[model samples]
Structures are given as structure tokens and as C-alpha cells.
Target: MVPRRILLETGLECFRESLNDLHAPATCATHLIGCVTTIFNFPPSTPRSNAEMDVMVKAVEKHYEFLNLAVSFVAVPRTSRQLLKLTTDLAKCDCPMSHPGSTQLHDLGQHWVNDMACKDVTTLLYFLLFVPSAILKGVNKTRVAKGSNKHWPRSISDIVPFGFDALVEALSQWTVVLANPIPLLFLGDALHVCGRPLFTAVTTSPTFMDRLISLLRITCANMRRPQKSEQLPVSYFYIIAVFLFHVMAQRTSQNSIMIWVRGRELELYPILSEAVTITKDPKLWPRTVQRDATGIAMIVNIFHAFAFHFSKDVPRPPGLHPELAPARESPEIEPVIRLYDLLSTRRDECYAPGCMRSLQEVGHAFQKCGACRKVTYCSKACQGADWKNTEYPHKLICRQLQSFIAASGSATGHPKDNFFEDFDQAEAEAVTAPLLAWVKARDAQKELQDLEKSMRGLAKTEKDEGAVEMIPDLRSNS
Candidate 1:
């Protein structure tokens, strides 16, 4: 048998050669990236080492093949675009059941799509969203502060802006989910990071949310009643749960859901309630994430929180069970909306009262408010009107956004786990409750005021001056 060192050297050489193949470098690189990800599943306690760090750095620290590591695929612009191109190309495939590897390829596409969706967002926010990045960014920031300015933190976008922009441009040109859901699986993971712009893209796409929700509904249905031919790929469950947060973010999305729920085109509350049962039973998912208690809770709570949050705005049909609304207030409901409210608008649409035009309809980006830097409008006039509107005015929320950076303790050298997974959501909602209650009450009061004014208009006032003449009417009555 070959020695272990020899085996390592041979594999490394082959990996290097495959990446440079002129015929199909992108395909070769994609497979390599995909397999390592699929094969090496491990829990948090699994041991790891820094040998997997930068190859060049490791080589410098010891004797090794530096040349093989020199031409990183991501460093070259052509290769970067090729990486994304691979996803688009693979999306065209139908993923026949004959080859189970096709499913693995589809899973790898999810990771690629997540990266593509997130690259355009602000790096600071992106770092906080992911679990690992939170730790890394904090350490990196402290180190940077201790060092000189030149040693400051940097991201791929900072060093390779063109490469990054090319990836985003490629993404825009290709409409995902029309052909396959694989590449777009975890795309919504970045929604909270990219915020309003990403939210607008999801809602306006027309087919994206429809297809996602349909798949989700089908997945849940299949889960409820098992059948051979009706079975769907298991990835749909996780992807749908993560991606559907877009529907929970804003009023427009909730309005669309209202239509769906009303027509019985789609329903989520029942499925979410079933999520606990579906995720808990090992016979259901076996050794996957769903089998774990934490995973079960996370999946179920995510659905419940989102559904509960938008419960009032998006109504359920009469006699729908669970009421879809768990409580009058939830940590996930109003505060989450308010904290992320800066990005809660449909960014491509006009924010003014009378005109809710879209960039797609108008074929251009709209003007934005300079003060809060939070909203956009069709024109200066619309912006002015929105700012001056008496009820739910943009002016009120603009400065609040300025004060609301990340969360209460995110940038204050404290961890951001609380803002996301770790925070005690039930307890904290109380603090934001009074403010939230006032906002809702004020909205209801405005609605009530409008109703009263309209009803009063039905009756003539003392100022009614129309005299004309019932004389003609009197003759008719006689």
C-alpha cells in the first residue's frame, strides 16, 4: 500500500491539476468544493485544526508545495464568475432520481446561492447574522484596533469589488427557482442581512415566493401523510423555513399571504404546528438535523414566531385552528419588526401615500431620503409628501432608525447571540411592548377617526346650504 504522505501528496496534486483544467475548470472545482462539504458532516464537538487555513501561510511555516496553492480559484476574476456560472448551469439540470449524487450537487448549490445572495450586503451586518462570523468579527476588530490602520479588517468585496459585482450581476441576469430550487435553497438566509433591498427583490420577483411556499406546503403535506411517489427531497423543509421569513417581514408580503390564505391557495399555521411532531421523531428524519431536540425547537419556533407575528395583519379563514396568533405580543412580533424596520419597506416601491410605484414599472431606481437614509420614493415630491404625511410619517421612523444601529448591546463589546438565537425573546418583548402597543393603538385610533369622519359625512351639518327647491318636489308629492 502507498504511504499516507504519498497519498496526501498525490491527492493534493490531483486537486491542483483538476482546478486548472482548461476544458471544464468550473465543473471540476465545483465537484471538489461540493464533496468535501457533503462527506464531512460533524457536530460542534468535532476536532479541527489550523492546517486547513491558508495553504501558503502553512507552507511558509513548513516545507510544502507552495506552487500548488499559489493560484487560488477565487482570486482570479474569470474563475469567480465561473463559480457562479456553474450554479446557473447546474440549475438547468432536472436532477433525475437515477443518480443520488445529483441531490448532493443540489445541496452544494444551496451554499453557493447563500454566498451569492449575501455578498452585496454590508459586511458588518453580514458578520453578525451568521454564528461563526460573530465570534470572528469581534476578535478581528479587537486585533485591528490594537494594530496600525493598514492592518485593519478586510473582506473579499473590499479587495475584489469587481469580482463581487460580477457575481451579483450574474445573479441578477439569472432568475432562480423558475427552473430549480436547489441553487436558491438558502438564499433567504441573507434577507435579514441585506434587508429592504433583498426583501423587495423577493416580493417583486412574482414567481419566487409562490414556488417556495408551494414547495413548503407540499413538503409539509407529504410529511403528514407518507407516500412513495409523493415524497419530496428533505432539503425543502430547512430551506423553506429559513427562506419564508421574507413573507413575515412587511405589510405588503402579509397582504399577499392574506390573498393566499383567503383563497385556500396556501396555509402555514397548521404545518408549523406539525413541525414539532415532524422534527422530533427520529423515524421521520433519522440522523439528520431534524432528529435533534434543538433543531426541532428551532424549526418549530421559527415558523410559530413568524406566523404569530403577522397573525393580525394577515388573517386566517373562519374557524381555522390554533388561531394562528399565539399571543397579543411576542418578542418575535413587533420588536423584531421595529429593530429591522429600517429594511422593512419594499425598497423598489414608492413610499409616498398616493403613489406606490415600483422601479420595475418605472425602469429606474428611485430617489432616497438623505437624512435617515432608510427609505426611497419615486421622486422628490413623493419623498416630501411621505415625510409630511400626518399619520405613519416617514419623518418619525427615520431618526429612530439612526438611533437603532444593530441591537441594544451588539457593538458595545458584548456578543450578538441575544439579538438572534440566544436572546430571551419572551422577556424582552415587555420593554418594547408599551411602545408597540401605543403604535398599534395609534394606528387603530387613526382608523377609528377616519371611520367616524366618514359616518358623520352621511348626515348634513348646520352649514349645509343647499336650498333649491323642494318646490318642484312638493308639486310632485301632491
Candidate 2:
């Protein structure tokens, strides 16, 4: 009945006041939710002017501000007991009221959490930083209490009705929002903050682990360039590799990894192979060749360990049947192999323009570019001439070239037939050879140490047979 613009302005003002106070009343929370719902439910069929859209965006921003404040409130408790009490109170306050098209306060809270996670970078960071610890500590307390006769007055379920579902939804939303490189950079501290709890939760929950693997595949596939000049940053690729390493390291159950590998092999293998090719190409990632190389090595080592340690669990090698050719053949791997072979065969070609001389053929000493060290020349004269040339001036665009190289390192053309044949052998020797050897040595040493410890324990038991017989059972009955 009232003018929509006037109603929106009033709601915004009330929401602003509530946000300004640390201890806002429950009514204020309810009022703010009402305001957000009103704006969202406004007629979609009616077209709006540019100015109206601007106002709508501002309203959405305000809604996020209110949601962020709610997370802060939830994070106020330091200990499990305090968190339990706060959660119980929140659950009570959040119960729905009888009204048309109205959501409960708790439902609103959950919606806000999910919405903030997808839309606001700052809110997402806060959610990652505070929510996981709160949930983990609360769950840990419940676990401890269950072992004793004494019980906690309240459980974590009292606070989070659906348990870790909210957290899972938040993570899923992150995958959707992180489809672009620019937003991936905004993830700044969230990755660091969420790492431990994320590792803990994924290892403990099969559903969480499944969601994380799905997220990884989506992120890797989306990392491709939509345009020639619009490639993702090298750091983004490195971050994905680091996350995969952490997940792999924390896995205690082999079944989960096996399931993931089998189900996701079609999607995951190519991305990984592509990652290896791009990182190894000096011309593609000029300045970051060493760092990218190291990252790729670590990732490959992790995969190698997975394959070596759990060979029985891993799926059978692809490309065994012609009828199933596409399923086994990877588009991402062949281009890399071809590119590597091409570069290896032409190892001595001068990179300088119009110079066809090869260091190997001419027996000339080659000089490397000091800045990128990616390209070589037959002589210093060619290098100087290339740098000074106006048509292809190397100095002006050296840094950009390095960035481009890093961005597109893994972007080879479509997959080739029979690409999977001898793929693992070539990849292991090229990318992960050194690191895999080191990992094997370390694992062997650990096994030897464990054997010695067991031997000593057996010796001690034999020497103290009488004493061991005298010792009473200390195991608890309850």
C-alpha cells in the first residue's frame, strides 16, 4: 500500500541503527530480516531504472553487513560451555513466528550465512575464520562428555540443528564464487584460517570430503583462460595444488581416497597432467619457473605416494579398450607431451629473432636471458640485439611475458589419441622424479625405525616376563 521507495529507505535506516549497536535487541534483528525480505520479494517483472538498481545493490550490501554482525555475535564465546549456552539461546530466539511468507530467525540466520558466503569477500573470510573453530570445539566437547557418566547440559546440535551442513554449504558456495582469478585473490586469509578445521572436518566426514573433491575439480576446470590475454595468476594454481596436498596428507581412510580417485579420475587426471606440463614449461612461466616447478613436484609426489601406497585401491590404468577410448584418453595430457618433446628435440635453437643457428649444430656458446632465463641465444650479440630492437623490444614487456607464461603454462590445445600410453613414465621422469625419490627414501627410513622400535619392545617383554605377569590389567570396564 505504501510507496516502495519510502518503505525501502525506512528499512535501511532501521537496519543501519541495529548494525551500529553491539547488543542489538531481538526485535531489531527481526526488523532487519523483514527489511531484507521486502526488498528481495519486490516485483521482478517490473523493470527498474539504473538509479533504482544502484539502490538495490546498496540494500544487498546492508543485508550482508547485518549478517556479518550475526557471525561476530556467534563467535563471542571462547569456550565450549559458553558456546553451548549461546547456541541454545540463539536456537530459541530463531524459532519461526506465525506469519505469511515469513522465515524464522534461525532460518534467516542460516540464509544470511549462505548468502554472505557467496557474495561478500569480507563476510566469507569471517565465516571461515570463526565458524569452523566454534563448531569443532563444540563437537569435541560433546565427544568427550559421551565417554564419562557426567553429561553436558547442552549439545552442539542444539546450536546447529543440521550439524555441519551449514559449513558444507558455505564451502560449496566458495567454489561457485571462486570461478574467477580476481575473487580467488580476495580469499587472502580465509584459506589460512580454514585450513586446519577444514582438514579435520573432511577427514572425519565422508560427505565433507566428497564436497571438497568436487570443489577441487570445479576450481581446476575453471582455471582455464576464457581469452588469450585473460589468464589466471600462477599463484592461484599453486594454491589449488597446496589444498590438494593438505587433503591428501590428512586422509586416514583409504576408502575415501579410492572412491574419489575412481569417480573423479576422468576429471582430475587431465587437470593434474595439464598442471605438470604448464609448470615445467620455462617459456610459459618465465619468472616463476622454479617456484612453479617445485609446486608441481610436490603435487606429483603426493599423487605418486597415493599410487604407490594404495596401488590396490587405485583404478585400473585407462586406455585398455578401443571401445572406451574417449573415457581413457585425456585431452590435457597429449599437448603437454607433444610440447615437451618438441622443446627437448629443439633444445639448441636460438630464441633470437631471424637467427636460425643452433648452439649444438654451430658449436657456439649460448647465453641466457638474465631476467627470465627462459630463452637462450647462440651468442651475447643476438641477445643484445633482441633486447634493443624496437619491433620486438624485450625490455618493455619482460614482466608481462613472465606473467603470461605462468598463466598459460598448462593451456595446450586439444587431447591427442593414445595420449595415456607411457604418460605416467614420462611425467614421473619429467616433473616428480627427484621429489618422488626423496619421498621413497624417507618412507623407507620410517619403516626401518618402526621395525627397530617393535623389536626393542619385544625384547623388553621377553626380559621382563615375570614382571609382566605380575602387572594387573588397567583397562576400564565401563
Candidate 3:
């Protein structure tokens, strides 16, 4: 076998040759200068340093090669757009499945995409931002129909699908590298690209939604703290949590619509509650900050998308009997409309008037009753008295309330391991009667509210409007 020293010298020579061939002379020289500086700056050699020195030397050699490679690629002269495409190809080529040895190559692709997206955005910003007066001159002006609006730069409807593809691919790779959140940043850019003006097609696009939700679910389930009690990286927690919150709120809404139609209230209630919880969390900023914001905006976007689609796209449940169709003609459909309206409105905003303060502070009220966990307040003091006073009346209608929200998603079909399914399992295994009671009570309260609304409307037409209308009269008339 060759002596170890010979092996070391050969390895160093290979590194040097790679630099010579792949890099420009000036670029190569610059790296060599850095390497030389590092070498001389290496402290005086001692007797204790032979093995360590060899390892250190190899590390320095690798750095030299990396610097050389970077310089070489820079000197190769490619437009930002060409470089962007090249980097995308490189990323795909270096995907962990295809080129495991160059897995780090993935990072290079990420960096390139980031640079190009940012640079392109910066160029556009410069034109539109500083020189809004010249916007007409910069563009070849033309009128476009709503259906053909994808061509506009401001709308970015054209780039949305490409952005979706990029996000899906990046997130797919992210399952393998949770600690490096660089890919999520790319997902964010894609999100922004799809979100501007009216790229509703991108979010609603069936092709992209599946992959997006799949990535989100896996990312959330994989989050774990590292061993040795070290603080897990911030990116790990942030990316997973944000993704989970979004998936629970947005994707599930779309998926749950079919469930809602199926009339699976037992399975659907918890999911709707969870969705509300995610949206209600004040710690979550609805707005994205440039640094930690990319994947998050998708949450807000998808929520609105799901709501819009639910309003315009969802068909009335066919299961409703012929007799109920007449009820649809009544103005009392207002409460039912309001309930559907709640699905489309931001939960915080929808629930705001019901409570005196925002849900985060002193939460709307009734948050204190053991039955009121479904209710929330900004603080404990608000919860305390509110619970005692409302508990008895609220208890009567809690189950109906939960059932209505649950119906929002569970009406379609019962999905295994899904939110609806998990809720059923939770109900069966529930160890605490109080917890179950609270769930039941919340649903009941919602039913009472709907009944009250229906009765109140009927009362106006019949007897004393001053007296509360009878539930029996409204039910019999229906």
C-alpha cells in the first residue's frame, strides 16, 4: 500500500488540479492566496500536532477547492435567467435520490434560486417602486380580459404554476433535510409569486394542492428536538409549526367539505374547532415578515381560497328533503347563510362582535365555563365570571354548536386517520367526562342559536314580536 504521506500528497494534488482546470487563472490565484495566508498564519508546529495537522490540512484543501469552484462558476458568464435554469437543473440532478454524493449540491441550487428570484423581484421593484411614473413606458401596453389576465407582470398569474412546481419539489426534498430551512424560503417565494393580484388558479389548482398539503403534513409530523438537550434549531420549529397551522386551517377545509356533506358531525367537530384554534392564535402574525415569512402567507391564501370556493363552488347538500327546499325560500335562511358566512370570514372577525374584546384578550366571553374551553378570552379574569353566568344556558346548546362547525368539513366523508376519524377515536378513548361534556355542550349551544334565529324571524310574521317565538311553531311551519 502507498504510505499515508503519499496518499495525503496525492489527494492535495487532485484538489489543486481540479482548481487549475475548472477555474480562471485570476480566480485560481485568489484562492491560492487565501490558502497561503491561512497556512502561514497556522501557529508554530509542535510535537503534538502530526495527526491533527494532517486533518486540518485536508479541511483547508477542501476550502481552497470550494473557493476555486465558486470563482470558476462565476467567471463562466451566464445571464441570471440562464443561471437560474441551470441551478434548477442542478438541484434536480443532485436530488438525494439521484446524486447522493453531491447532496450538498442541493444547497448551491437553493442559493442560486434565491439569488435569481430576489434579483428579479428587485429589478421589478426598482421599475415600479421608484419610477411608478415610467411604468407605462417600461411595459408594452395592452388591454387584457379577466380570463387572459395571467399575462400581467403585477398579477404574476403566469409565473404562479412554475412557482408552485418549485415549492413542491423543494418541500419534497425538505423532508430529508429538516434542519436546513432554505427550501422553505423558496416555498415562500413561490407562495408570494402565486399570491399577488389574482393567481387564485395556483392555490385552487388541484395539481399543486395535493403536494403542498402532503409536504406540510410530513414536515409537521417529523418535528423533534435534537438529543443532548441542545435547543433544536429555530427554523425546525418555525417551519413545521407554521406549516402545521396552515394545513390544519386551510387544506383540511377543502378536504373536509365532502365530509361535511356526509353528515359526520362526530368526526367533523374537532377539526373545525382545531381550524378555528389555529386561526384564532394571536401569536401567529397574519402578515409575513421578509425573514421568516415565506411558507406562512400560503396559510392565509389557502384559507381565503377555500372559503371562496366553498361559497361559490360547494353545492347544497342533496340529502336535504324536498320539504326543506321551501325553507330555503324564507329569509330565515339568513342564519344558515350566516353560518356559511362564518366559514368564509376570518374566525376572529366573525366571532369579534359576539364578544366585547378580541378573542386573544379577555377572549369574547363564556371562556371560563368548563363548557367554555371552546370559548376563549384574552385573559383569565374575563374567563372567570363569564363561565359561571353562561355555563347553564350555554350547556343546553353546546353540542349543536360543535356539530355545526364539524359539519363544515365532515359532511363529505369519514376519512381514516384524518381529523374527523381522529375525533371519533378521541371520543371513544376520552378519559375525562368533563372534556367530553364540554364538546357536547359547545355543539348544543350552536343549535340553540340557530333555532333561536329561525324562531325570532318567524315570530315577526305571527304573534307578539315582543315575545320570543316558540321553537315548536318554527319547526312545524318548516
TM-score of each: 0.44, 0.33, 0.26
Best by TM-score: 1
For candidate 2, the clash count comes to 3
Please provide, for model 1 over 177-291, each residue's C-alpha lDDT reduced to its tens digit, 9 standing for 90 to 100.
2222332332343333233444555555544444545555555555655432321234445545545544455335436544434433335555555554565556665243334
**Can you write out model 3's per-residue Cα lDDT over 1-478, one digit (the tens) per residue?**
4443443443334335424542222222222222232322223221135445444444343343333332233224334455445333322321221222122222322343343332221211111111111121122111211222222233222223234434344343333332233334323333322221212333444443444444444333332222212122223335433333322232223444333223333222233223323433444322221332333333433333333333333443433223221123322222322321232211222122234332222223223224412443445554443444443343344444455434423433333224332332233222123334434445555565677676666777666645654456433342
RMSD of each: 13.7, 24.0, 20.4
Q: Given candidate 1, what's the lDDT at residue 276? A: 46
State which candidate has the highest lDDT.
1
- Given candidate 3, what's the lDDT at residue 343? 29
How many collisions per candidate?
0, 3, 40
Give the winner by lDDT: 1 or 2. 1
Model 3 residue 64 CA deviation (Å) reads 31
Error at 72, model 1, angstroms: 17
Residue 329, candidate 3: Cα error in Å is 31
Reference-based lDDT, residue 450, model 1:
65
lDDT over C-alpha atoms for residue 371 of model 1 = 73
lDDT of model 2 at residue 459? 64
Per-residue lDDT over 300-334 for candidate 2, one digit per residue giving the tens place of the 0 to 100 score = 54444333323344454553222222232322232
Q: Which regions of candidate 2 fall more than 4 Å away from where they truly are?
A: 1-163, 180-233, 253-256, 259-262, 282-292, 302-311, 315-478
By lDDT rank, best first, the candidates go 1, 2, 3
Task: Give Cα-based local distance difference scores for all models.
Answer: 0.41, 0.40, 0.32
